[model samples]
Structures are given as C-alpha cells and as structure tokens.
Target: MPGETVEASAGSVATRDARTGGGTAWLLGSELLTLFRRRRTWAMLGALALIPILIAVAIIIAGPAPTGRGPAFLSEITNNGLFVGVTAILVAIPLFLPLTIGVVAGDTIAGEASHGTLRYLLIAPAGRIRLLLVKYAGAAAFCVAGTLTVVVVGTLVGWLLFPIGPVTLLSGATVSVGDALVRLLAIAAFVTVSLLGMSAIGLFLSTLTTVPVGAMAATAILAVVSQILDALPQLEWLHPWLFTHYWLGFADLLREPMVWDNFIDNAVLQAGYLVVFGALAIGRFLTKDVLS
Candidate 1:
C-alpha cells in the first residue's frame, strides 16, 4: 500500500477546474484584502479621519464661526454635528480625496509590476481583462472606503464635540436628524463616484509604465489641472465637459426637493471617462509585453 500511491480523484480535478473557471470573485476578494492590508492604505485613511476631528476641535476652541465666514455648513456645525461630515467633504473634495484615489488607482497594475509579481498574477490563470476589471474594482472599493472614512469619522467627531439637531437646507427647509443622515450618505456616495474618472485615468497611466509614483503624480496633477480649468472664466466653455466641474454638485442632495440635475450630469460625465480610459487601458495592457 505504501509503494502503490493512490491516484488523484476525478472530483478533485473537476473542483479545481470549476474554481479556476469561476475565480473572479475570489481574485477580487484577494485583491481587496491585499489593498486594505497595506500600511499606506491605513495611513491615508487615518489622515482623512483627522480632517473632521481637527475641524471640530478648532471650532470648539475658536467658538462658533459667524455665518458665511468659513466653509459652507461649517457655521452650522455649532448647531448640528451632521454638518461636520458635509463640511469635511467640501474641504476634502478639492484635493485630499483625489490625492488618495490617485495613489490607489495609480498603483493598481504598476505596483504589481514594480514588485515583480505581474507575471505571476497573469500566470495565476487570470485573463488580462478579468485582472484589469478586478484592479479597477479594488480601486473603486478604496474610493468608497476613503469617502466613508471621512463621513463616518466626521460624524462621530462632530457628535462628540458639537450639538446634534435638525439641519437646515440651503433652500430654507429643515430636516430631521434621520433625514440628514441619509443626505450625508448620499453626499459620500457622490464624492466616491466623483473620483472614478480619476481612478480610470490612473489605471490607464499605471499600464503605461511600471513606475507607480509617476502614474500617481500624473493622476493627481490632472485632477488639479481640471479644477483649475474649471475655475477659469476664459475656459468656461469647457467647464461642462471637465470631470471636476460637477464634483461639488453633491450640494444638490441637501436641497428640500433634492435637485437631480447635477447628480445626473456628474454621473454621465464620470461614466464617459470610465469608458474611454477603461478601453484604452485594456488595449494597452492586452498587447503590452509583461516583462516583469
């Protein structure tokens, strides 16, 4: 019996085949696990969490800000803690959010190649398209995570440091705490979606080279430049097409009737960028040689 080794069972091989054929979910989970496990990811999240804490602390120390003196909804934080999350989002949307998204998305493929693991990943039986989708999904997951970090942390920090009550909308309507919480979550979702275009751009750039830092910088710079262009009066004609144009449109969700025009416009703009850059990344990656 010791000399005659038993052969592998047919069921085992069939099970392995099935797993290999339907492993996209497994791969995505592994990708997200790997992403969140990195210290850099946590560090970025911690930095984001500080935004609200610092805002709340400063407001507490400096006394209530006069209306129209600071960030929108900042003065309101003295009355309702919920505004803290919204105000933090307004502060972060300009640069912090995009900076973090750039790092994650830019590192997607390039990080694997930089670590000399790209070849192994491809040989893991992951099709290029599948792998690319998983990478984007991972980046997208980080977007959600990062945005929620600010919102939830901001809310908690605000609650501990400020009063909680009904929030007044810009349109002269007040809403209950429960309704305001829903709007805060909606704002977070809008902020997350706002970063997708940058994510796609970063992913495409990541495929261009093995230098993750370069891709990250380019992605961040593009975000800054887009905003600058959006701010230029002479370039007003191009504002509608710019990805950053509708970023702050999350304010629409806070309105009494809740305007949907900006939300719809931003979603359409982001989707267009996703399609164009996603296709480009796919084309470049599928044909490129994976030397690493």
Candidate 2:
C-alpha cells in the first residue's frame, strides 16, 4: 500500500468534482470582492457618476431650453448606457468606456506577472487556461459593473436636475421618457458587449507583457487608433469590419422602428472580436513559459 498509487474511489471522485466546482465559484466571487474592495474601483465609479451630474448642472446653469432639433442638453448628458450616457454612442464608446475597461483588463494578467504570482498560478492544478478564463470573466464582470454604474447614476442625476419628459433624438424623432429609458437599457447592454471585446483584447495584450503599465498603455493606444480608423471616411468599405465602428450602432435603437441590420451586424462583429481575442489569450497563456 505504501508503494502503490491508489486510484480515487467513486465517492472520492464525486467529492473532488464538488470541490473543483466550488473552487471555481470561489475564484469568481473572490475576484469580484477584491475588485470592489479597492479604493480605485470606488473612486472610478464615483467619478463616472459625477460626470452626468456635472454636465446636467452645466446645462441648467446655461439656461438652454430642451429642443426637438438635436438631443436636449439633459437628454444628451443622461443618455445613460446609450453611449457614455452622453449624447451619442459613437462619442461615448470611443471617448470613455473603452479606456476604462482597457485599464482594468490590461492590468489583469500583467499585474499578476509583475508581482511574480503568475508562475504560481500556472503551476496550480486549475491550469493556465482556466486561470486566464477566470481573470477574463472577472475583468468582463467589472466592465459591465462600471458601465452600469455610469448609466444608472448619470440617469438619476440627469432626471432630477433636468426635464423628465419625452426626449428628442438626433434623427428628429420624439420618444417618451419611459421609452427612452428602455432604449437606454438596450444601449447599455450593447455597449457592455462592445466593451467585452475590448476587455478580451486588453487581456490578450496583458498576457504578452509582464509590465502592467505597458499593457495598460498599449491597450489604450490600440483603442485610440481603432477609433481613429473607424472615423475615416475613405475606409467606408472597412467601417463595418472595425470593432469601434459599430459601437454607435446603439443609435439605431433610438430610431423609429429600430434598425436591426446594422445593430445585429455590430453585435456579430463584436462577438467575433471577443472570440478571437479570448482564444488568443488562452493560447498564449497556456503555451508561453512564465520564467519570471
């Protein structure tokens, strides 16, 4: 018995399965807990919440009446989940949300590497791919939370300070406050998916570098470049292919009858990015030697 390798009994195997499942659950829960416990996370959420409030106050002080022309100042600021909860999804998608997600995700793997913990993680029975997936899931969860925080806080602040009636969209269509709220939620969901692709890209980049700062900076630069490329008029043919291009597809949700063609296209494109980047991250994480 001392020299023999004993196979696990059926009861032991069942217990092991239970433990593995519990470990995964704990990993996810602990990651969320750790993220929220950080002072930076609270500070970031507070700052985002203040953006819409500050903008609403600025509009009120300026004394501009709501108009049917473009989005009313209040509506623009409270766009919530629609874009940055700002006027247009196009502007907010590139302007703020991606940067926020990038910073958090970009730091994911690299932060562990920088601290010399990645090697230990890789050595664990959970394996490198599973570890990477856990980190990705954690980062994506944070992105969703951050985006929702901005939308919910901004909307409440905007509604309290400004008018609470129908909103006029850029397309010159009118929608009731309730309808606008629904649209805003849909936009938020879309924006969350869009940012998930960015999160995956950031996570992938994070795996390629040990310096967390470098990963963060590279992700931001990539996002900025992608946004610029998305804006080019000459690249009309390539616009649909750019991840940043469809970020504003949420605008379609605001239009009467709701344009599914472009919205669905954007969703599909973003999904593609998510899949590709996630696979790349897992592949590199599994194969790369973490000598550090």
**Candidates' C-alpha lDDT:** 0.86, 0.68
Give candidate 1's error at residue 291 in angstroms.
Answer: 0.5
Worst lDDT run of 10 residues, candidate 1, spans: 2-11
> Which portions of model 2 miss their true places by more than 4 Å?
1-21, 65-91, 168-175
Assess the local accuracy of residue 61 in candidate 1 as a C-alpha lDDT between 0 and 100: 92
lDDT string for model 2 (34-77, tens) is 56665666776676666666655665677543655444333354
Give me the overall lDDT of model 2.
0.68
Q: How displaced is residue 7 in candidate 1, in Å? A: 37
How does residue 201 of candidate 1 score in lDDT?
96
Q: Residue 28 in model 2: shift from native, Å?
A: 1.2
For candidate 1, give the lDDT of residue 23.
83
lDDT (tens digit, per residue) of candidate 1 on 157-214: 8888778998889899999999989989988888888899889999999999999899
Point to the candidate with the largest lDDT: 1
- For all predicted structures, in order, the TM-scores are 0.92, 0.82
